[model samples]
Target: MTEALLNVVGVSRSFSAGEDELTVLKEINLQINRGEMVAIIGASGSGKSTLMNILGCLDKPNKGHYFINGQDTSAMDENELAALRREYFGFIFQRYHLLGDLTALGNVEVPALYANEGPHERQKKATQLLTRLGLSDRLEHKPNQLSGGQQQRVSVARALINGGDVILADEPTGALDSTSGEEMMKLLRELHRDGHTIILVTHDPHIAEFADRVIEIKDGEIKDGEIIGDTRNDNVNAYQSSDRAATELVDNPPQTHPQTAKQQTTKYRINWSRYLEALKMALIGMSNNRLRTFLTMLGIIIGIASVVSVVALGAGSQQSIMANIASMGTNTIEIKPGTGRGDRRSGRIRTLMAADADALKTLSFVDSVTPTVRANVAIRYASETVTGSVQGVGTDYFRVRGYSLAQGQFFAEGNALGSVIFLGHLPVRVIGVTEPIESVSSNSDELNVWLPYTTVSGRIFRQNYVSDITVRVDENVESEVAEQGIISLLTMRHGTVDFFTINTDTIRKSIEKTSATMTMLISAIAFISLLVGGIGVMNIMLVSVTERTREIGIRIAVGARQTDIMRQFLIEAVLVCFCGGALGIGLAYFVGVIFSYSGSDFQMVYSGTSIIAAFACSTLIGVLFGYLPARNAARLNPIDALSRD
Candidate 1:
């Protein structure tokens, strides 16, 4: 004899309620034949729904063995049971537990996706099924947009998408009007005629009259394990009369053949099609709630923009400071009379003199030495009188200080003792005379006047002392070693080390280091904002998981593994963060450009590495913060999730 399609032996199920065990089903022994329409009927609070759930592999039986085609279901794991539901059983929920995020056509393709069906095949099959159910015009409508009867039809189409032989519907028409209910019953009858086994649970006795067999269940026990009420003798006769056709239909189900069957045998372990479908759904969900999505992304955008801009500004500041230092020559040292200390007595030193400058120039690595004498003198240029510094220097001042002559020439060697002087810190025409060095600054520009050392000591200051001296060392020599030599020489010449001070490349490096540290501090503060943004993302994702509990349940019902649901939410979060990060990068550059053009001293340098790092970090933040919410969603109990409002 052929084995029964579904067999239940002494099945019982219970729940713990207030320290008392309430049994829902007890010793339910039943057998459903292939291609038979069996209805399990009972009043309110009866165990008919529980029996249907167990039959559908949606819930486990506590004390029984359920066999599907002689294979015991009790030994199967959750994944295997999900496969059985995906490949062999189709459920039609009473409330039409459709995914609100998916349209009718997408909903119908769900089971096929889990079965690893190709997109074209699933689409074609879903289209045909939806059209056959008279929902072709409503294929793109979401659940909330559809009427009760239309939704019921969509659910029916979903149940048949995987070519399942067993249709376990729990109160399929319980929520519909009479006319819609009658239409639903007729569709089930047609499916039964087409060689599908229909196990329906209902409370309506009239509805049970149409089935080939009705098993009445009260409380947790079956009243009679046989056909009752309306016998449907004519329907039984028709089934018997068409037994040969039914057998043929069962052997070769609709829209399937030898090649398709052979292809089905090679089940794909990883269903990328489901992932693609999930991504599409996630995008749709985000788009539908545009305001919330944007609000959620705002934190990341601001944080990344702040960080990128700070880093860019810091880089620009370092470059600018180094450039300013390079203008004075990296191998140059400045020797001022005072020690670099915050004391007035230490600054009043007249130890550095013209002889010291000549002595320094005689060193092996020293290229040039220019002793400076500063006088606050007033110059009159064509009715303009300005008071500024008139500097006395040697002829090699330009080469030593990295300054350039935009127009006029420097003083000749013969003019060293001559009265001829190159004027700076004054207007181009002084007393109807044109002077050089007017292009570099808007205020008092320094004028270079070359004079013999003896002439400057006697003529300008009437003293033999110089305020400061600059030494240009050869590029091949170490400036630090030269600095030590200059200090030792000055100490010996002055007879006291506290009387003079010298610096070589140390001031520029100190400035660069200080600027860098400031920049890092700013960047660190920006990262704190990024951390705040990550926390915001976590909160928003948790709220999203809570809001979509029902939708999560529907996906699980359609054969979505926990990982699938987890991945879907994770993708949504990452997509939001990536988009925000991209926008932040754009904003950073835009603001940088504005600041650069706005004549601010703070310039921004956009680095390729910084942009890439910012975006990568933002994506990582999404993943790190989104995991908890995704895990919460994945670990949800499908039964409880479905019941959530």
Candidate 2:
């Protein structure tokens, strides 16, 4: 007895129809032997197509069992069913069902792609199949570019790509003209002659005549309720009676055995080839919808740019501020009369004096010291009288303040007491002008006059005590340690703490802390935009999945695994975000260039770490937002997806 290649025993399929169950097929029993060309004829809505789908593993029956070559299909999982579809069966749809974006050869190679065939091998086989089907000149033509007959030929070629042990064709000639339909039937007969079990589903009686045995189905049940064919019969006589020319054309048809094709389904630990193919598909999808892809990336671009630019701006501003602070002299301390600035009696507590400066200079930790006395005065220089601040200081004041001379020299040790500018009523000679200091407290427009404390205290204010003292600490000592020493020495000398000291180092630390806090707060706010962008990606990808439902169906029908479908969409999403990240990084650098040209005191300083982090963040957003859409696409029912308009 001949073994049945495909067997269906007591199978029933039902669908939900608005609270009522609609049974499409009931108690269906059939058995198809190898190398037999059988035609299943039925009218529209007769469930013949559903039966074909079930037989091809595209749909499962709600009840009973289906077996393929003694292996029960009811026991197979989705992947296993997919493997069966890929290795054992090939479908030729009534509508041709070719992917519009792919060429004739490309469409033919899809099944082999899922079968884990190498690109070179699949392409060669696809080319050979198409050429043998009389489409040698149309290998690169897309489906839309071909005639009905040419497309059907390409569909036939695709069906044979993976050995196609059992060919389940659903109204394969329904869409073609009489001449094309005849050609397609003739081609099917040729395939049937080459040891293939061909199951043809059609409504036309004339088409049924081409099959060796005709099985008529009506209202989801076999006519007369029998299996309809003999247990075993030789199909050689049937092939010999076919048209001689068509059989001669496929005399040496590609010999791909079902068992050999089945062995190819044993996959590797990581199918890098499938991933690479998915990546290629992702690029093609992105290229085909350039505008939509870019629009989807817009939010990510703006978010990444904002985050990187804001961080760079914060870093740059902080650097500029620190530089200005450094101009005021590093590790410097100021001593002023009174306990603090808010003290009401600070002006009257004039215990801080020149002696304190001299005493601080004597300490090992003190690098230099200057006693300062200030008086606002009017000075006449060449008949131009300007009100200015006159500061009295020791000769080392300019050096301790980190001031460099612009044009004039500072006071000599001997001339400190002799040369001075004559203020409103005091007699003083103009000696020298120091360079402009770039400290935070120094204003470029403010006129400053410096003189010896001996001259200012004796000739002008006539006060024995200095207004304040400035001490530059040695580089070897920490500022806080030097501050403690100065406080203790001053307390002992004065018998009490009558003055307050301001450490520049402490001010630097506080300013740095504040700048960092503000940066983090702003960066966090910018990060919100990234989250919004990720949501946008998810929304767009969901819409894309809906739009490409038919495409997904086609891939699944052509033996694609759920993982394969998910991987392609996921890769596309990730590519969009990654490209957006690259563009965003470029935009940030461009913004930096624009900022530099604006003549600002500071330049934007980009960090390598921040740029890398931004790139990683964009990629993460892609994966996080893309998974939902990919999963939804992967989980779509193939039959429903194909039925969707």
Candidate 3:
């Protein structure tokens, strides 16, 4: 009278070949309650396997309603069905489905991953399960290293992890020798006695005798299904193979859409339980080419460091430059002439004149415009001729050119022209002036200088035109708007976009933006390296899968579900990328420091964002690129996999 753990009513599944429709299952009905074991017995072509597939929810019947724990399976989507399977069913098969990369304990811990238990709890549970399954000694051993019985035991332990009520076993004893097969049957009997609802599919009549019920499937339908013996609906304690504690081996199956399972994979093993395995694998991988790994990591380090350092140092340099410019005066706009020495009005005209500079002062937004004359003349102090460049400017030039006189005051307006000039440090030092040019000390020939424009207005240095017209706009106006206005005015005045251009505050921002763009480009390049690293991870994992094929086949054969295989490989890949990312982050910071110290204006910058970004990016690359190899490992046929060697 107890509620059936599983109920299949009028279920049918079929396939079409050319014009013929072949029914795999036809109008079948089956019901099983708690604490009972049953077998569907038939020959290879008799559709028992097809029925088993439908029973396991690995495949859907063409027509039928399969209810598990009273939930209508037909009403559920693939995702819901997968979730239900994970939560409510376990599986065992003829070939043990033990994961190759994972030790016995790790294999046992696979199903619990979907439950999201912490690593500590998962490991504890896995350990207990392996011990109860008599795999305690094989806990650290890979499936390849274990005997057939041992591998099956690990699969059994994995299946039992979630304590799922039903065990759907397909050919539970098909791949084993008689002794191993008998042992497996004994284990199944023990599980049945422990209150598990098991549906076993087999062809051997002797195997069917162990079940409380037997369904003889022929063609594509259940020809006869009858309860062969008294079925226990209460606790079947005697059937529980382990006694150390029920926690020894729990039961749970995979949760994944079969179709999507063929496409995307999102599976991972318990990290804490398999941390050592991952670490060991990492060590082995690293040892395989310590120098290559180190060098590859070094490239990432340098790349990250170069990028970070450049950002930091560039930011600092820009900050300093902006400060200097601001200090020089924000209202100022540069009007320096170009290198082309063409006539002021000729084709591709570049040579500027004082007249053009004077005309700019008349603009409505303009406040002050100073015509500036410049020449690298070797002026004599007294037998000492210094070839440093001399700047002959109007009174307003000091405010526009960011000239902070190192010492004495600058030139005055309308003052009488004398042999006076404000020199920069280079000019001051060049003249070998021991003291200030006037009342102040200039220890070296400081070159910074200032002079009235009229002084050089007709001299050999300049006659009519000045090289530049530094414009100081109204302080109240937003400098950017003023600069743009000035650019528009000048571009119109010049009548040619190529005849020198304006690069004011508006354009200055574009430079910083361009720097950011360059950073992105560099980042893209670095990501390529990470991808190469990901490929390394994938390649390594694929190799591992090949080496462990037999082990995988064993787990799948016994009871290790598809998801278990996927988790183990993905975890391995993620581990590799994470380790690489951590190292890369550290390297980037150091490179940033180096860039900061370099003399170049550009410096590297590091951010917590970048560090996390690097890690996340690597993880994504691992999953995106790693999943293919991982899935290939997971999807390998158990029959073909174990038969490899």
Index of the highest-TM-score prediction: 2
lDDT winner, 2 or 3:
2
- TM-score per prediction, in order, is 0.77, 0.82, 0.54
The 10 consecutive residues of candidate 1 with the worst lDDT sum are: 430-439
Question: After superposing candidate 1, which stretches have Cα over 4 Å from the reference?
Answer: 220-235, 238-274, 325-331, 334-396, 399-501
The Cα error of candidate 1 at residue 591, in Å, is 2.6
Superposed Cα deviation of residue 371, candidate 1 (Å): 8.7
lDDT of 1 at 147: 98
- Give per-residue CA lDDT, model 1, range 1-645, as digits (tens): 676778999998888999998887778888877878888988777778778878887788899899987778999877777777787778898999887878999889988887778889999999999999998899899999999999999999999998767888889889999999999999998998887888889998788867888787765344422223333334453342245543443344334246565465553334555668667877998998899899888889999999999999898888877666655555578777666756586446677788888888889998888887766666555466566566667656666666665444565522222122223332232111123332221222554334344555666667878767888877677788888899989888888875444554776667878998899899999999988998998999999899889888777777777777888998888888998899889889899889978997658888999999999999998899989999999888777788898
Model 3 TM-score, all chains together: 0.54
Query: How many times do residue backbones clash in model 1?
Result: 3
lDDT of each: 0.77, 0.84, 0.63
**Candidate number of the best lDDT:** 2
- Put down candidate 2 lDDT per residue, 1-645, tens digits, no spaces: 745768899999889999998877778888877677888877887788888999989999999899887778899889888887887788899988898888999999999999888899999999999999989999999999999989988888888898887788999889999999998898988888877778999989888888887777776344422233332233425642233343232233224566554455544423878889999989888988999899889989988998999999999999998777766785689888898889899889978878788888889999889999998999865557789999899988887787776654677733433345468777566556556665645665788888899988988889999988888888678899999999999999999999998887877778889999999998998899988988999999999999999889988888999999999999989989999999988999999999999999999999999999999999999999999999999999999888877
